[model samples]
Target chain A: MSSVRLLVGTRKGGFVLTSDGKRQDWKVEGPFFAGWEIYHMKGSPVDPDRIWASQSSGWSGQVLQRSDDGGKTWNVAGNKFLYEGEAGTHQWYDGTPHPWEFKRVWHLEPSLSCADTVYAGVEDAAMFKTTDGGTTWNELPGLRKHGTGKDWQPGAGGMCLHSIVIDPTDEQRMFIAISAAGAFRTDDGGGTWKPINKGLHSKYIPNPTAEVGHCVHHIAMHPSKPKTLFMQKHWDVMRTDDAGENWSKVSGNLPTDFGFVIDVHAHEPETIFVVPIKSDSEHFPMEGQLKVFRSKTGGNEWEPLSRGLPQKDCYVNVLRDAMSVDRMDECGIYFGTTGGQVYASPDGGENWQAIVRDLPAVLSVEVQTLP
Target chain B: MVRVELPAHLCRLAGVGHEVTVAVDASPVTIAAVLEVLEHDYPALEGTIREHETKQRRAWLRFFVCEEDWSHIGMDAVLPPAIVSGKQPLLVIGAIAGG
Candidate 1:
């Protein structure tokens, strides 16, 4: 029987959870790099055994770790992320110009074809890539050097390039989203980029329909339909059919569209999932009841998936990168919570169960289906 | 040879024990010289205690020698006699923080 592995990054550390295709019985492996903040962990698509983790701390800065033998052992990779040219300035929280500085890595996206290549999305909002495994990282400076960079400001979270999606159909095309700066696209393999937020509107910024200052929480794309993308912005759930040329609100019927995570289903391209929180101020589920909403027709219509989930008095929040899916025949869905629970739905979002509870506040979750 | 004690997390990261010894070649044996040798020996600790480019000490880490806080001292200043003579170890500690 085939199996699946879930690489989970938490505030405290990283954990590896493995289970058969049945998705019921599980084996939990870590708290690896224990006591350090693991912001993200991902495995290569071509080589599932190879994994990379972003280990960091306020006192120690950042350390990149790579595992060759699955999650059995790990070695520290290069952590030095220097800008291509002079590091410039961007708008600070008080609207003052502040120098750009390197912070922590927020997300990692392994290459779709090569095991040795990976992309890192980092705070102070920049993009970096490593082609020789994780030994070195070079910044793709065009994204940060855009004309409107100085006008970009931080969201509630710091200014971070938190989401990255590569076009499986076209290797040179890619998409990245930065908090409070809207979404950007690169068609020449990271050499250049342009803001793709044509129809996005954020009431928080001075210009709601400006070229770039929208806080995009997370964006998702299915492999088959790379042009169609789903996004969970700061206050709205949206979708785009022309590969982010434009986006429209598809948040209809959601009790509250304000949430962090959004992901496309494995087998069904039109199906998607979102965990709706009460609002930006209150980062918990509505009525203190945890729920995962599924939209089968891709946005305007949604239904609550509450069976096996906490129905009352549960206030855990799901983070932006905390949700994922495995490419199984039945398509298993997975997500982690701020309350330290990793929930799984083997049969899409109809039912769910916690694989492990009381581990740590999960920052990210990535699943790999092994043959 | 100089004796240096690292914080628990750094020790784990460097795959070393609480205390490790290093030989410094700089005259008068300054803190920067010792750290240069330490990072050279343990590449995993390259950007942890200090910034990779700026070479500035991380804000959350403090340096101590002979019960005195040496965190804010000049990196090139000569080590105290007790520390220079290996009678006492230079301690790298995480500042008291976090909830």
Candidate 2:
């Protein structure tokens, strides 16, 4: 009998929720990585033995950690990218200091094809890649070179690369979404990237191109259909079939299209999930009502799943990387909220149950199945 | 010496339903001392206030002095006279999350 483990990362620490395959009784063990802000945690789909986490501190910028024996223990693997170099070679570059300085790691994506390959998105709009199992990392130069002119502005979290999706079969192909920089993709690895933001709205740009900052929050890809992608933007939920060459709004039926995270089923490519929140006003759920909606045929239509959720007026917001679908025959959907609660659905979003409540602010959720 | 206040969670852990006061005599007050006093008097908060595995400060927990964040302040840094004098309570808060 296989076991299921849910690694819940929170603002204060990380918790590991384990259960039998049925997920009926869960045992919570944590706050692992105790004193660190764990923004993202993932168990490598390619290699279940490898688990990775992205952590940050108020004073300690960002750190990447990994574990081989599930979440029993963790080890820090890399040095954070600090703007200042050693002693006295140089102090301040120009009148203004260098911009490599970062305060936190906002997201982490372990490549589906490679066990050691991982990507980290951090504060101050920086993206880093670790090919050697996070022991060493290199900054994605193309992203650094992209000019964030007056039109490309950073939001509350700064202009960070919050989402990165690498094609499972094609390691060279990848897509990255910047908070205000829109979405960009690379076919020949990171050698070059092209903005693919056509038909997306950017309040800052007079004419938003399919290639640059359009206030993108998150992006998800269907498992079977490599080209099919879904994105949650500031004002709309959009989809692209031609590999991001073009996009169209598919969120007319949602209670509110404004959402932070978007997820697709592991095996059923057509089935997708999203947590809808009231936009424009502080990004909370509608009238404090939180619902996770699933769309079987892409984002054309959605069904609400909140059977076992809180009955009170609960206005909770789910962050990007806060919701995920476990890779199994009967897929399980899990999501953590800012309100410090984690909800799980064994039958993919058909019904829901709160696995753990009032733990802390949940920053991210990653699920792994033990063989 | 500056004073600090405790939220409900920390207060419960401290074994006191209400806020308790601490004295900081030197600069760069170590979190260890604060925890020692808390544990010696409160006891109930011993396990939760520190890391379960390493006994270090939990990353998600924050220490604040009035409106200023005390995360970067070294463990040895001296507390302001007001704090030592019990004028204001050093606030130990759990970071808030949701959005």
Candidate 3:
């Protein structure tokens, strides 16, 4: 029988949730790395035992942690994240040049083929990779050095590179997204990159459709169909069919397009999920009712999946990196909320149940389907 | 040998007790020399007490020698006789801030 392991990062610490293939009766373990801000935790796809966690604190900067024996034990990996060349400047909120700085890591994406390789997207917006487990980190300078970096301004969340999607078909190609800077794709394995934010319009920015100043909230890609991608921007739900050469709004019938999370089903590439919020000024759900909307045909028409979810008086926000899907036989979907609740839908989005309630405001969630 | 006291969080990170001792062999014992020895003994404490590049004390951390605030003093300043003689322990404390 297969088992599922959930690696959850929270503002207070990290928690590990485990359950057998039945997906019921979970055993929640930890407040591991207690009292530290765990921005993200992820297990390698090739080796389930290998896990990487980003532990950070306002008092003490960043600390990278690695676990080889699952989550039972952890060792502090390298914390040094120096920029490659002379660290240049980016756009400040006042349209002035601001020096690039290293803050806490926002996301960790383990290599699909190698457990020792992992990529880290960090605040102040830069991409770093650790090829040998997590001992050392080297920045792939091309993305930051690429033209228009100076124009990439910070969002409300402090300019962060939060989303990373690796192409399953070609390892050399991958996509990364930054807040207030839009999305970029690297064709030659992080060496060279290009902006892929066409058709994304934001009214808040000076130019509604600028090349690199759009604040993209989050992006999702199904492994089987690398060319097709889904995006949940600050205000609109979008899709790109031609590998991000261009994009068109596919919000369809969603109540309000303002959302933070967007994800694809494990087996079905066209099927997707999103939790719509009220608006940018109001981060809570519409009418204080929590719901998850599913689109069977990509993104035009969405149906609310409210079974077992809070229908009234629920005011929790789902962060950009807080949703994930497990590749179980039945396809399990999971998401964490700012109110410290992690909800799981074992049989897709038809039904929902909370795995753990009253954690310290989850920051990110990643699931591993183990045999 | 000089005695040192670390904050609870840093003690856990360095895998050490609240109070630990480090031997400084330099002729003139400075605060920087003690920290160098302490960091060498526990590599995990490298970027915790001080920034890696600047070697400056973290904003939320304070250094004390027998209740005298040594945090604002220069790192290269010679240590007091009592601290050098192991009579007083160097205190690395987290500032009283945050929730």
Candidate 4:
């Protein structure tokens, strides 16, 4: 009997949802990193013993922390990069001087091939790679070449680099998505990158393909099929089977295409999950109805699964890192929203239940089944 | 020198009713000095501002100078000129946590 656990990350801390094989009863523990804006957290897919988290201190700045012994203890890595720096140390390329300034690491992932290898997607829209377990890091060559440099324009939430997906079977193949830069992939590790935004729609652009505003909020990959992927684009939901060579809209059944997070089943390559929100208006759910849509046959179809959800009017926006699928065979699906509520689906969205309510805006969710 | 007004939560801890003034001669005042005065005048506020075990700033508290948020400012960095000149009050805000 394999057990399952859900690790949820929020603006103030993180929570662990534990369940028996039955998935009926659940136990929630903690506000881990209590009081920090934990954007992302995950136990290494390759090595479950190691865990990493990206936390931002509204004004204190951001820090990347790692835990080797699960979530019991944590340690910070590298020199803290400030948004502003002293006379000679280093300053934000933009020269925006301040008392303390540093780049905020919005997402962190451990490499699939090297346990010590780590990657961080920063708020400055840059990617940093570490080979020695985050002791030191270097910006990727491809991003450096783009040289948007100091003038890297930030979107509504700043120039955020949110998602990085590495083909687990082939470590050299990687996909990275920036908020306003669409999506890019490199077959040769970070040596080269090409924008794969052929079919994505950008509300800010008359021609979404040729413009840089086709922002990608998140990306999900089928565990068994490396070439198949799903992305929550700024204005649409997209699917690509040729490793992002092209994309097609797959949100026909959804109420609205504007959402931040998407997830794929850990074992079922065809199964996927998404949270839908209204577009153009206030960015809330359509008619204030919060629903989690799942497509068991890839993105060809979708079904709203909210059996145990609230029946009253509810408006909430789930962040990019707030929804996730656990590592269990059945794979419990979990998500949190800006309204400070968390809902879980034990049977991969066949049914839903609220685990906790009124917590703080949930920023991210990660699930790891403990050994 | 700029006067800083603490929120009710912090003010109660500091035991001062109105505001506490700190002398800052530079343009950008360091967070460390502001915290030092806050701790000196109302020692109880120090432990609340930072974690007791690690001594790091608490995640729920934020600092501001005028309309600009100073939470990202370095602990040892200087306060900006506008804040030192009393054009803005160094404001401390407590972030709301929980769902």
Model 4, A333-369: lDDT tens digits are 8888888888878777777877888787888877776
Candidate 3 vs candidate 4: the DockQ winner is 3
In terms of docking quality, model 3 is: medium
The best candidate by lDDT is 1
Tell me the tens digit of each residue's lDDT in model 4 across B34-91. 6766666654454456543345666778877668777777566677767667677777
Runs with alpha carbons beyond 4 Å of true place in candidate 3: none
Local accuracy of candidate 1 as per-residue lDDT tens digits, B1-99: 889999999999999999999988789899999999999999999999999998999999989989999888878889987887889999999988888
A74, model 3: CA deviation in Å?
0.3
Q: Which candidate number would show the highest TM-score if scored against the true structure?
A: 1
Off by over 4 Å in 4: A79-102, A147-152, B1-99
Query: Any runs in candidate 2 off by more than 4 Å, and if so which?
Result: A82-100, A147-151, A204-211, B1-99
Instruction: Estimate, for each residue in A1-371, the C-alpha lDDT of model 3 and write its tens digit.
Output: 99999999999899999999888889999999888899999998898998999998877779888999899999989988888998899999999999998988999999999988999999989999989888889999999998999999999999999999999999889999999899999989899999999999999998899999988999999998999999999999999998899999999999999999999999999999999999999999999889999999998989999888888899999999899999998999999999999999999999999989999999899999999
RMSD of each: 0.8, 8.9, 1.2, 8.3
Candidates' TM-scores? 0.99, 0.75, 0.98, 0.75
Give the alpha carbon lDDT tens digit for every residue of B1-99 in model 3. 999999887887778999999999996999899999999998888888888888988888989987899899978989988999999999999888775
Docking class of 4: incorrect
The candidate, 2 or 3, that scores higher on lDDT is 3
Of 2 and 3, the candidate ranking higher by DockQ: 3
DockQ metric, candidate 2: 0.04
